[model samples]
Target: MIANPSDVRNLLESHYFLFAFLSSLGTLQIAVTGSGIRALWLTPYRRVTRWLGFVCIITGVLFFFGQPLFVDGPWAAGSVQADSTTRAWGVASWDELAGARNVNDIHGGLDGVDQAIWFSLAAIIAFSVSVVFGALSIKANTKELRVDAKLDDDDIDGLAGLVHRSYFSNLPISVRNFRLEARKFWRDGVRSADRWSLIKIISGGSNQ
Candidate 1:
């Protein structure tokens, strides 16, 4: 695959569109994960955390495969030469080009391929680090929520208010008001004396 530098460059360049597509996919994945996290009453906390972790894994894999084209190095540096060679090869006979060999041919005469390989490895390492940090965050939040469950009503209410404010802090005034109404409904449910209502409210509030 690396027999010719031009061939390697052309192959990588051809994947430019693929790289863009994967990046778009990653962005969509993140947006969906964020939306899921915001719907606290609708989804369980552990499920959200697990889903986020899964999304990160998919994003990381895509990034590892797709980010090399954007990385600054030999891939960008050799573009002009690759383009010229591609045009020249179009006019030249295949046999002539195939027979041509350089005395300095080493490691299949493709230097950029080595750099891309290393960059891909670096991307994987970065992805691994992100997953580790994400997992730790999930663990810490899980522990905190567990502790919060045992707190008194006042403390729990205070914590709930804090969470509500933080979650809606970035929204517009109108949207925030709407979310607050929903919050009130959830709170009222939590305070209900009916057995079924209490169970449902507790499940929703605790999930958040």
Candidate 2:
């Protein structure tokens, strides 16, 4: 992530600043949830928020790592400017330069990285936005349970522990809880589908 002063300055001056800011926000959300500190979360639905964070990180990593395919950098194909038109127009030929850029075109000049950077940058933005949506959509627990009512289980689920205790004591349990919640969500969806099918079948039989 380290860069020269000039690159940093350029990034700040360009739209890339928004990209970087969004990515940083996403990374920060992941850090907060992964560390098991729920106090800072916008909503009380821990499972939904954590899942959103998980998806965000996974997407960001994939897009960032897949830059070689989407990005037409110096190492990309047709980067050497093999012909006069390519050298002059930075495209394969004058026809390509005159025509709209094709979806398959990869020799888009020195600004290739600019075109491709949006994929990863968008992923970064998606990550941050997903968690916020999760927070907004899920309902918070209505009952005001005591923070340390059940220190081991409740404290892990509750927002009582400070940073150190939250990290060391609750992280493992938090991850496990997320897994359980995922399984439950999947099962619930399947069950609902089955019930809908049964209802449809009964209605069809009565109509016949």
Mind giving the per-residue lDDT tens digits that candidate 1 earns over 19-126? 433343344335434653322222235455445545655665555444433443222322323533332222223233322222122413325564466446544544
In order, what lDDT does every prediction score?
Answer: 0.40, 0.44
For candidate 2, write residues 106-207 as lDDT tens digits: 233224565457546765665445445433432233133234355444334423442323233444666677788889989998776766686767777333
User: What TM-score would every model get versus the actual structure?
Assistant: 0.24, 0.31
Q: CA shift at 130, candidate 1, in angstroms? A: 5.0
Off by over 4 Å in 2: 1-22, 34-36, 65-76, 80-139, 142-208
Q: How many clashing residue pairs appear in each of the predictions shown?
A: 0, 0
State model 2's lDDT.
0.44
Candidate 2, residue 84: how far the Cα is off, in Å: 16
